[model samples]
Target: MKKGNTLFFKTRPRVRSYAAICGSKEKEGVIGNYADITLSDDMYGESTYEKAECKMLSGAISLAVEKGGLTDCDIDAMLSGDLLNQIISASFAARDFEFPFLGLYSACSTMSESMLLSAALVDSGFACNCVAATGSHFASAERQYRYPLELGCTRPPQSQWTVTGAGACVISDAVGKIAITSATLGRVRDWGVTDVNNMGAAMAPAAADTIMRHFKDTGTKPEDYDMIITGDLGALGSRILKDLMWEKSYDISSNHVDCGEIIYKVIEDEFQGGSGAGCSAVVMNSYVFTKMNAGLYKKVLFAATGALLSTVSSGQGESIPCISHAVELESLAAGAQ
Candidate 1:
């Protein structure tokens, strides 16, 4: 936990750029505007549940390649993961892209986890460059994990809306070196929060724990970073996390932001709280990347949190367990003036 610039000084590999690609299936939902779904109608005509994820992953990778100004062949490798059982989304995406592949699964935290691994690979001389990650969600997730949307079941205020979008990021050693400097993996935390409907409550503890650990391990304070962002802990979880941090004396209230809350713009009654895996993915790809490129912020801590629960677990009366992945990204370019 000794924090000084050791990570930077110990190794001087350059990190170039971080690019994100996003896709979604909900074309007409009230929250669709918050996402980046723009596929043709025909694409979804015969889309099976698995195909939807595959399409999203492929679209995300293509966009990342385009935005990063690199060809698929130029990519050193592709690292991806999804909510699917066998990671079909990533597998199919790899088939289309000619890069070596490494599939990952951290649930909603997959994007950050992939980025962390990709950066490490590039910095350690193992690989010159790689596309870190991507993710997707569909209406089918709810049907499989919860009740069908048609059931009209009322979601509690603490519940988060699953976002139907996919995101991809190209991480390289050549572009601008906006690399992931470090990462801290979180341990599973269950605070006796058993409301299957309220994921925010279940995930808040893990978010707080991981954020605290990141600061402790890196010897950095909240004020040291321009932004401290969390993945998808919605409104209620965000509030609880803020309180927990205060209790732990971190006091990150001012600079802290939640991807879930920010993605939906917190419109009144528009979305009960915020969104899902795609929420953090799209926000980082579209909004955060733009701001970083514009020099709006310098150092950021990206913490994506996930609720590790299933239909079977909840049905069997199991409490929701949660985890988070935190990574720090900083600008490495020299000429600011």
Candidate 2:
């Protein structure tokens, strides 16, 4: 059933399995504890950072499928994305497998966007199994969006580090511990913040807008969810989201957490924390999934925020149009109880 911007999945596609792999730096952080694989080197033995990103993405997908006791051939579709010019990481990763591929790009919000569509496809009987995945490489993103690492440009306090990681989840028609119950499609909102360095500020408004719409459409409230997780709003953006929601009479402060703010063990050096397509992906697949399976979290409202800005658009003096897509995941055990 469709309600406003939200789509309810009666079939309840289950997350059959998931996996995450992070770079050397992330390996020293919180995500490293829960990630399935952590590399000793960010390069992963690849000559180019771009190639390393592809390898990470491919490894994540393969591991997820293997964990489910399945193979690439078992999956009907592969939906993936990355923070590259043409989503080359995802597209090239898909080449390693034989499944039908659809490469998506929603900036940092690509994880939830891909998973939302994966649920829809499985719920509609269009596919029995699908892999939703996304990844981002710090080195690759720096070269593409900002100054190359060779230049050693100083980062601003408002700037967030692009995460070097990848995550993948297999959504299947079969029953499982956690199931995707609904999804809220977000609308674009630009507040005329032209500074590309401050992505959290640019995307927070859209996060609030989507969260508000999700509550309204589903006849729910902030307290209904065990956790309200935002993908990559960092510390500054997370505060902005709370303020925006408060103005609308929805207080999410108690239950809310931003993946970007907590992905790193220490936030001082990284400034605003981590921001990338992989930030939320790795967090969801590793930490959040572990908590859910352990019965610590029964219901989760995952809203992955994205800054829809390109180097061309920014250079043209255009504002950053942001978006956030929300996916509702519920533990089947909670329902059974």
Candidate 3:
């Protein structure tokens, strides 16, 4: 049922299985050991970076299904998105599967957005099994959103590197260890940030707004969750979000973690850190899921933030509008559901 902008899943859709596949760069990052598959080459043997992104998405979906002991025939639907125009990466990846396809475009927040829809579908009996996935490639994103990589543009200190990776989760009604309990849809918030290179600032306000709304709708506090994770707010954005929350009398400094900040070991070398459609996707599927299964984090509030800016909008000098969608995930014991 709906409570404010949050949806409470009484039936609690469980994540049956998940997979994380990343390029060599991401494979060497903090989540390196946890990813299900890591490509020795970012190209994945493909001739082009775009095709490589599609292949990564496809690989993540297939790996997730296989981990769940299922096949394409068993999946009722697939929900996916990416940073590419028209979400071509997700669309092209979907062509490799046999199930119904639902393509989404919410910038970096596509992971949580796709998972929220998948959970709702399963919880409401619209589908028995669904796969939620997304991906992004550094080279492809650079070519599309900024200058061509061939130009060797000097990245600003505030910029983040686009992660070359993909993550997928199989959500089903079947009993499982990790369950999606609720979700809070975010609102578009533009604070007049026009610097395309500084996506963290563009997205931070939305993350704070959605997280605060989720707490209000659920009658919970920041301390109620074992962790509160934001998609790709990076180091600077994460700090801004904390300050925003504190101004509202909600302090999340203790439990807050940003996927962008932790993805890399030496984050400053990559500017803030990682930022892309796959940033939160790979982190949640690899690090977060592993922690939940190990009984490390029992309750997590995951809010994936996105900057809804296109090249045309940037070119037009339009401000970047951002959004964040939050999902409440809990770790349940076997047969608890």
TM-score of each: 0.87, 0.98, 0.98
- Candidates, ranked, TM-score: 2, 3, 1
Candidate 3, residues 273-316, lDDT tens digits: the string is: 99999999999999999888776888999999999999999999
Residue 25 of model 1, lDDT score: 30
* Over 4 Å off, model 3: 334-337
Compared with the true structure, what per-residue lDDT tens digits does model 1 show for residues 1-337? 2242123312433334333333333334333443344554423544575677677767777767776677877888888887766777788878887789998877777777787777777777777767766666656566667776689766655567676567777777656546567777778899988887678778889989988988887889999998998988877888899999999999988998887776654445524455556667767766676566666678889999887777788888989888888878775544321
Q: Which has the better lDDT: candidate 2, or candidate 3?
A: 2
Which residue pairs in candidate 3 collide?
none
Report residue 86 deviation for candidate 2 (angstroms).
0.9
Q: lDDT value for candidate 1?
A: 0.71
The local distance difference test score of each candidate is: 0.71, 0.94, 0.93
Between the candidate structures 1 and 3, which one is better when assessed by TM-score? Answer: 3
Give the Cα error of residue 208 in candidate 2, in Å. Answer: 0.5
The alpha-carbon lDDT assigned to residue 335 of candidate 1 equals 36
